[model samples]
Target: MKPQERSELIDALLDGAISEADFLRLEAELHVDEKARRDYYERLELTTLLEIQAEAEAADLEERIVPMPATGRRTAWFATAGIAAVILGAIALLSVVWAPDPAGGPLAAKIDSRLEPSATGFAVLTNQADAVWDSGGALTEGDLMPQGDLHLTSGVIQVEFFSGVTVILEGEADFTIHSPMEMSVRRGKLRARVPAPAKGFRIRTAEGELVDLGTEFGLDVTEQHSEVHVLDGEVEWSPKSEAMRRLAKGKAIRSGNGGGTVELSAQPGAFIDATGLEEKRAAVRASRRSAWLTHSRELRRDSRLLAYYPFDQPAHWNRTLTDESGSRLDGAIVAAQRSTDRFGFPAGALDFSPTGSRVRVNVPGEHRSLTFLCWVRIDSLDRWYNSLFLTDGHELGEPHWQIMDDGRLFFSVKKRDATKKQKDKQVFYSPAFWTPALSGRWLQIATTLDLDARKVTHYLNGKILSEEAIEDEYLVEIVRIGPASIGNWSDPSRDDPHFAVRNFNGSMDEFAIFGTALSATEIAELYENGKP
Candidate 1:
């Protein structure tokens, strides 16, 4: 086909005006010709750019047409430019309004498939109050909910589905999320608010299914029976053995495992709503915050603390991170921005996303045993090694701590007399504990090096993750922390200008170093007091 003819065919395709035969021809051409694929993308880009330019022009009408003195050549140029702009504007308008039906033809289907967004999750756990899971796993606010079962043994949680359905679940409850608009209650109580967009949201029980019709409703499920209460709209209840029945506002029904249904009165007050849940969460957070502050004050007075950065300095002290342990080991903040901490305190954390972002400190002593703990929110593990802390350079007794690309916690101290043959000379690693699902969630990570016991222990959220024996060859009697950096590695010993890119892509709210190795109970207390 000629260039003009092919362009016309693409235009027709984009406008949804291509006939079946023409679409087939275009599909074959796109499959065989690389130029055709490039042309398609180029056209799409051009249309998008034109649309953006049009919107910009509309926003500033005075700047849309600029006056210029006209020469004969300028006049001709302006005429050509005006014609081109008009054509581009028409194309943009057509592209915006005339989308092809995805089911119309093979080409349309292929294009639509490419344009679809990738599905990450069915819903999000938007809010929670004093939640305690049956599995003893931590589920925080703003966690993405995948298609799986949730067993909440205590407290309340609010989940907002992608399809605009909100559900407040009260424990002890067993719930399963099948999709954005579908869920199941094995045994529990829940209140749901379905917007117009999620009108067909359905909840299944052993006895029946309750489908929402743009309404607020509550449900209770047990071993013997299931109850549905329509609070403000309508629902279609389908019993396993009976025909479907529509229930209006202020109506309720009960379906039993024995195959019978009974009418009941809707009690809106029996289930907690979103507003009530939020109020409860606020009270809980305030109480937790107060308890944490009191514990923090006690921690600062502890003699074992070598250095502690609460990251709660006022705006005027942005450049210097205060050392609460009173060791005078202040840190110099370099190129890091302040951010909100996990507990919702403003400027209570330091974000280290930019290159060369770090907190430089000088501890000025060697230790026989050490404990390091911090609260961090990792955004990504993009680098081969995401630095947590590292001494100036790799010398004997110098410690290096970091997260490996595969999500394992890594710590090592250089040994003075290590042979090349020893494979495990100085390195220790915890099991891989981080995944994409954990991105942006605050985590309490702690590592202790107990030289006397010859053991290295790693903890996550106060729970032991791994404990490895410090081999005889790998044991360093004294660990040095004269000059080091948090969230990045900096080597002042090197003459060369080039440096390794090991900066952490995350935020840190609290970091501390103890001269003595803390026991498991101490670590647990720290997590419990500071948890958000």
Candidate 2:
């Protein structure tokens, strides 16, 4: 191969975008041509220097300059033979993938010309709203990363580095791409998954560096310090001004200008993965643009709306669910598993097992007209009554929604039937059609009680599934809405009284309560908007 052609192929290979035929040709040339091998080694050394420079700059350290060889050839500053051996042994890592930049521009233009071939980053797994690129240009998936700061004012992103490290970065965060194997988080929370070949991958923070000792970990950085949590394997935490510490699996450590501290428990769940990336993003967009937040003046507004729970919390063991209405009735989660819902993003929903896990919310006071809506995935029908929503009591006037043993949608409003001969209290039952094998998948449901009309209605996916008329004396006795619970009945008399009975065994997301029945049009819009 000619020198220019060989150089182009080498560049493409380093950048991870060379064609199969070109790669084969380059391999053959390197085996037969001594000069080609030398050129490749020189380029490798040059790439290393550029990587070190990028790392230094990203860490805000004083820049160190290395003079180029007089013959225009680059030699390794450390030992080249060892790097070459490792590179050859890990030849499979050379494969590259590239796609057109989303911003419709050349990805390499912003990179340094001399080290353009080894530009950092592999792909933009995610690019959420309002993320700003400070020095590196706006990036899309598959675009080569130019080493610089990525300042996200709002939104989250997942970036995959060429070294097989994946990082999910949260918004209000700032990050810098130092090299394929190194990065710096100035301010943000990031979850990183590093495979074996990328064992030495390092993340630098304001006060320390986390060297991946073959582990999946998370790093949160602030103006004063950095925190590290190892989810799996082990990691070496080296604080710039303190003694280095080794964090084993399930361990966490924090370092700042003050000193370094080791945490016994992964209490904050720093290493938890993002459960639902897409659903969480949708929830964010909806919350930001929903009529409740963005268009309060419009007629689409419903004043009776009490609470809206999107379940879009960060990736953590415990989260407080915020009520997005004028009422700031926050809910607390207890031992619930967070994961992707139908929407495919992290924190879209919480998973509850037969275990006592459930969410506790302060219920609003009872209203004449009430509506309850949520997205749920049932795991089974083992229990007689699988509760979905329930207030604290089973007394007259309190309302609850559940699924019957035969898979029927059940909703009840407390009332008395005076016609009973013995003066015995009478309770009514209204059940909707049973969806065959309706477990393990997501479904949208709404149950509404319109007191003035004396009617009870249930909706599946926005359309009415069943409706029933109320008795003449039927009255909703719910004086207080809460201390309400979700995913299980409020009955504290079961064998495992602590967890309640008939616990939901699947996921629930985007639950809401309103003081008025939602119009069919409004329900339809909600269903459409909430679709995954």
Candidate 3:
């Protein structure tokens, strides 16, 4: 790329407007071109210096100069006596704020590392029964198990390592996943079933480590001691101060924190096995599915609903999504595929990962207030704007609802006689609530625009996330949603041939639009009844 173009791309990166494609291109350039890397560091340093200068001016301390050591290639330029003292002082201050490597490495390398995507995991959270994590958010069944500390305060969870080792952990425990074949227990009980392919699976504890020899075993670890029980096969035990010994099935050993080991008979019933956990999860799923079905039936009868899509088609190839609210405003699926819903029912949801994938619908007439709600499982936020419901063309009185790339919930409406300036537009944003850890987990997202009350509210899983007042100058008395789309955006008035790609990278099982703003009690009830 040209120097000007590279600078523009760098500016966009700083401004948070660089597209994924452009970002990848810029990253590749920085990796191969030494000059580009230097330019990037120079740009970053200049930006930081400007910010410091602005702050100093604001504090009326611009005259003060602090001499600090400078490193890197910029040191020679700073040593020149011709440079302004204030600029040199600012550069010195910037160097202190962003200390470079003592060996004189470019700062671009550090910044580039931050731009790289997060590491991928080899294990998956296969199942959980009433699992309550210490982090507050429960891990969903299909979530990828991150390699880190896992604190389970209550219930049981099953994890399947890539090496074919299945581990069922009981609650009130602290565990860490070092790799697919290795883990550590600080405090808790767990049962592991290792197949022949994963024979050498390892488990470390405070006392020592246990190496599985294609065996099924139960391990309990606490501050005072660690215990191991060979449930079905042989395992090699190595205590901190004792010689490694192999123990067969029906044998158990306990090692105290201070020293010595005690032998005892194996207690297979002490830990919940994978099979038992599966049975419990199945029962809970069945109960939740039944309750959701009854709740869905009642929701269809709500008189204030403008349109409701259960996304429950009779067949996978069905293109029409029936409106359960009797509005006859059925949606036509466009290039989206049928997928599993939050309830684990096959072909019960619509996946909108592909380009041009959306559910096209038309709801006639304007409304004084509006509410948009849905249950979505976001796979990733790959686009600048991941659409939930956006009106076509974005004309006056039309509303747009979507999720920002940073995971904030966004809702806005075009006002009557509004100019192109962004300040004239009223937009509501909720604090970012989604993260990489939340990928594939089902979430209830809702947004209400109460023009009469002059307020907008956003909800996540039944609780209010944010509330913003609708300024009188920016409020549209009648909100319109004439021709719109679910999971994507369509701009009819755009002169450019290439359309913006804003399709949601995930699945949605249910969506509803209410004619009036729903109360918090009603939204909470909806979440309670529909949650899986």
Error of 3 at 514 (Å): 0.5
Per residue, candidate 3 scores C-alpha lDDT tens digits across 1-532 of 9999999999888778999999999997886688998999998898888765454344345576443325452544434433576687788889786676676664466445436654578788989988898999766776778668989999889999999999999989999998889999999999999999999999999899999999899999989999999999899999998999899999999999899999999999998897899888777777898899899998899999999998877497779999999989999999999998887788889999987899999999889999999999999886768999998867788898999776899898977543455453688999987775678889999999998899999999999999999887887778889999999988734532233658999999899999999999999999999998
Clashes of each: 0, 10, 0
> What is residue 529's positional error in candidate 2, in angstroms?
1.5
- How high is the CA lDDT of each candidate model? 0.86, 0.69, 0.87
Residues 1-532 of candidate 2: C-alpha lDDT, one tens digit per residue: 7899899899899888999999999987886578999999999889877875454344344565444344422345223444666677577455532344556553353322323353434444443433455544555434455556767775667777878888887777887788778888889888888999999998888788889987788787877767787778889988887778888887877777677565654433553255644455667656644533233233224567787777767567557876766588888877678866664556668887737677788875767888889988777655667778877655556677777655677777645433445321223344534433344556788888887777778888788777778766555544246677887766565223323466777788878888887877777777766654
Could you tell which candidate, 1 or 3, scores higher by lDDT?
3
Q: Model 2: residues >4 Å from true position, as ranges?
A: 1-302, 416-436, 477-479, 494-500
- Give Cα distance to truth, residue 360, candidate 3, Å: 1.4
lDDT of 1 by residue, 261-380 (tens): 999999999999999998888888778777888999999999999999998875945699999999989999998889878776668899999878999999978899999999999998
Cα misplacement distance, residue 345 of candidate 2 (Å): 0.7
Cα RMSD for predicted model 3 = 13.0
Give every collision pair in model 2: 16-96, 275-346, 276-345, 276-346, 277-345, 277-346, 278-345, 279-345, 397-477, 397-478
TM-score of candidate 3 relative to the true fold:
0.67
Tell me each candidate's TM-score: 0.66, 0.42, 0.67
lDDT of prediction 1: 0.86
